[model samples]
Target: MNKYSVDKLPRDIRIEIAHKHRKLRKQRGLSQTELAERSGVSLGSLKRFETKGQVSLESLLKLVFVLGRLSDFESILKPDENLKHIEKLFDSKRKS
Candidate 1:
């Protein structure tokens, strides 16, 4: 089993992400209500996110920004290294 990738897990990814968020919140010593207030998200939304891993984009964004993890998403859609190498070859062919 790959230790770094969660792709093989049977658990829902949303639940896993929410668990990470919940852990981060606790590590930062923030309560759900306090996180809601600080992040400008509703308490109910925060609770739902932590408990059931359900959240709207706006609420999730607010929470992510408040958590100072906005930059963590920068590589979400970044090309893989092998894809990048192939793209380099493709670009050279196009430029020829």
Candidate 2:
């Protein structure tokens, strides 16, 4: 999906991206269903996006939270190289 591809992103970045999504949802004070209704996303898909990091079209739509200043969900979706570096440090420490 990215220029480098999803696989190129570090795992920590993936987790961070997932975490940011959850945080944004919570900040908006909307239940999964409410968010879905407003965003035109499905509840089940929303739940999966929150817990599993697997986003559906509906899940992507509910990111608007103008009332809560919780916008920019898309900006945080990108992968980070720092995550890969952190993971490598952990792996080396484990091996040691």
Candidate 3:
């Protein structure tokens, strides 16, 4: 496994990612409370994620599907460092 860290990410990019996540969530008409209920993520955790851009993949997947942009998410949420690894793994396993 390749280890990667967010330590090299610029502050602006981090902020942009958080903002984008929050914007998408809001565009789907979900209050943090509602999103938390539907996505099984805590309201506090969602709030922190909106501000920090650091949440578990499972929580993010739930939110993305609820936000009506699962396709966009399938592309955008692949952080650069993990892109090649994911591509290789998926290429090896045919999608049903």
Candidate 4:
């Protein structure tokens, strides 16, 4: 596996995501307390996530939903368009 594979870089990715979330929260003019109240997430969880990149999926979803960016998560785990096309081609060949 490559030294920079996804499995090897989860920590980095999480930190980056935390940074982006913090930036967006500030851009939206929401303090941590305000966001936590609006999103139904605990202020502790939000602070931990912002400072340490540690948060549960449900809490993260609630935060993003309150930030108006929940739709961005919909594409996660979906097949890539190019991969889908390649799979379709293989399926057609196998059925022939």
Identify the leading candidate in terms of lDDT.
Answer: 4
Local error of candidate 1 at 20, Å?
Answer: 0.6
Q: What are the lDDT figures for the candidates, one per model? A: 0.87, 0.65, 0.76, 0.94
RMSD of each: 4.8, 12.8, 9.2, 3.9
User: What TM-score would candidate 3 get against the native?
Assistant: 0.60
Give the per-residue lDDT of model 4 (tens digit) for 1-96. Answer: 237564647788889999999999999999999999999999999999999999999999999999999999998999775688898899999999
Per-candidate count of clashing residue pairs (backbone under 3 Å): 0, 0, 0, 0
* lDDT of candidate 2 over 8-96, digit per residue (tens): 45545555666777787677676777777777667777777677767744446445453244455566668875698879899999999
lDDT of 1: 0.87
Candidate 2 deviant stretches above 4 angstroms? 1-11, 61-96
Which lDDT tens digits does candidate 1 get at residues 29-57?
89999999998999999999898889997
Stretches of candidate 1 exceeding 4 Å from the true structure? 1-11, 79-96
lDDT, residue 19, candidate 1: 99
What is the C-alpha lDDT profile of model 3 across 1-96, one tens digit per residue?
113764555555656867988887777777899988988888887888798877776887787777876677556646576478878788889854
Instruction: Choose 1 or 2, whichever is better by lDDT.
Output: 1
lDDT of 3: 0.76
TM-score of each: 0.70, 0.50, 0.60, 0.77
Q: For residue 39, what is the lDDT in candidate 1?
A: 88
Residue 79 CA error for candidate 1 (Å)? 4.1
Off by over 4 Å in 4: 1-8, 80-96
